[model samples]
Target: MATGFYTHPDCVLHEMGEWHPECPARLQAIEDQLIAGRIDGLLERREAPLVAEADILRAHTAAHWDFLSANAPKSGYFAIDGDTVLNSHSLTAARRAAGAAVAATDAVLAGELENAFCSIRPPGHHATPGTAMGFCLLNNIAVAVRHALDVHGLQRVAIVDFDVHHGNGTEAAFAGESRVLMCSIFQHPFYPYSGTENPAPNMVNVPVPARTGGLEVREMIDLTWLPRLEEFKPQMIFISAGFDAHRDDDLGGLALTEADFSWITAQVKAVAQRHAHGRIVSCLEGGYNLSALGRSVVAHLRVLADL
Candidate 1:
């Protein structure tokens, strides 16, 4: 089966500001690169349905929903935090971004697709149960994992986050939940610097310093993430797919290249094939540099699609 691609037009309508790194153009860049690389044709495309309130509540508290709804601006932008902002279309876009994850999960588990990729954003992974930050309003990957665990009756699920910054929100949501194991690598002393300290027993958090390259990432995953994932033997695997660690992206200092993204995807895919019957749901996180983000996503997709 082809890999599933979930996205929506509303995702492009939401904008933080002209100067923000997390712009709607990021999606366009990925789409353009996919076409240019001839990778778009290998996937089954689907429009992301708006997420149900109950699904959103799986990963976030009702208070978080109420806060975003109450603060959503009617015309201009509202600042949720110093870096996160909401415009008139932000709520709708965020909902669709989350919905894409849910849809991808359903499609993957139903055997309609081998695996799926969600290309919607304001890139989630930073928003916690009650707080939205780091250019994220909803924790998309967390919501999907919860749906897989609760709604689909899956007992074991693993989340692999490789964003340049720590996935503090995702970690917080599943901290003590033994059913879920989160293995991740991120730049140390970076934004939202919190992963290097004591982590939950279920978490395999690796803090790679700046200027680290693919060799370090490979070693970390081979030595740390793979073992935890093997022992957990997850029924499904979810990825917090962030490409900001690419050398071209100055948003963070890691010097990874497109080859690294492909390597990581291959590693994750092997884990899925071994333990999860090849079930995978990947959602976009942080990737700021337009060209590199586009190219990196295509490389990752090539591995996922096995093309």
Candidate 2:
């Protein structure tokens, strides 16, 4: 089976501002790198559809949906927080971003693809059940995981978040749930300041200090994450693939490089191959530097595509 690549043109329509780090060009950068590397043939592209309202409700409250619907601006930006903002196209993009994950999940589960990658944005790991934060309107990976478990009848699933920041919202959703095991590592004392106070037994939350490199991160994952995953024997695996930890990204202090991202993907891929029959759905989370983001995504995809 080939690797499915899910994305939408409308995802580029939503923008915070001309100066915001998360911009439309982020997707374009990945496209450019793929074309430049001549690896387009390795992917099976799919357009992201509008996510069902029921799907959104599965991962978030109706009140959260109402909040976004009632407040989405007609002409300008509506600030959800000091940093998170919404415009006319923001909700549209968010829906597509989440839809990409759901679609990829369905495809992977159906055996239409061995694994998949969602390149949509308004990156989601920070959005909670009833709140949107960190430029995220919908929890894309959360929605997809719910779809995999609920609609696809999957009893066990594992989520591996390699973002630079803690996946506080993902933890908030599945902390006490045994059917889902979440393993993640992020810079400590960082944004959101979470995943450290106390974590559930099903959660393997590793908080590394700033400037931590790939070797330490890998060792930490080997010690903490792999054992839980092996015991869980998940039917499917989900990845919150964030490359902001790359040394070139100014948004984070971690010292990961493209090689680090590749290593992480390989590790996760190995686990999926062992227990999941190679079922994996990866969604984009963060990575500000365009060059680094593009290269890192390609590196990650190369492993997934085995190209």
Candidate 3:
């Protein structure tokens, strides 16, 4: 089956600011690289819809939605936290970002596609049940995972987050939910600074130090994450595909490369093939350096599409 690529133009309109690293250009960078690599034509393309209020409520509180709506400016930006901000197009773009994940889940579950990639922003995994932080307004992956379990009647699902920063909000959302197993690798003592402490049993949180590279990442996956994931035997797999760990990205301190992204995708793809009928849904999270983000996404897609 072909891989589904879900994105929306609104995603490009929600700019934090000219100086913010999470600019609208991130989406364009990914597309530019895909076209340059001659891989854009290989996948099925689809526009991401606006997610339903019910779907958004599944992962976030009504109060959170209310706050975002009330604070959405008509022309300027509203600061949600130190780094996170909401402009006029923020809500629409956030809804579409979450919507892309839900649509991708539906497509993969229906066997209309083998898997999907949601190239969206502002990146999620940092936004929590009642709070928005880390440039995220909605927990996109959490909403989709809930939809797969609650709406689709999926028994077991797994979320793999490889962002340089821990997915604190994702961990908070599914902390004790045995039906979902979250495996992650992030820089320790980094932004949000909370993954080193106690974690839920189902959470395989690996906090690698700064400057850690591909060899260590592979070892951790083989020795730690793979075992738990195999035992979990998830019915579906989701990825928080963050590329900030790339050595070229100054936003993060890890030393990962584009080759590392490809290697890790291959590993996760193998896991899906072994246990999940090759069903996977990947969402964009954090990759600030435009060039590295684009190159890394190409490598990731190449593996996901089995090219």
Give me the runs in candidate 2 sitting further than 4 Å from their true place: none
Off by over 4 Å in 1: none
lDDT of 3 at 96: 98
What's the CA error at residue 7 for candidate 2, in Å?
0.4
TM-score to true structure, per model? 0.99, 0.99, 0.99
RMSD per candidate (Å) reads 0.7, 0.7, 0.6
What TM-score number comes out for model 3? Answer: 0.99
CA displacement after TM-score superposition, residue 171 of candidate 1 (Å) = 0.2
- Model 2: per-residue Cα lDDT over 176-206, one tens digit each: 9889999999999999899998799989999
Candidate 2, residue 31: lDDT: 96
Span of 10 residues, lowest total lDDT, candidate 1: 189-198
283, model 2: CA deviation in Å?
Answer: 0.3
Q: What digit string (tens of lDDT, one per residue) describes model 1 on residues 124-165?
A: 899998899999999999899989999999999999999999
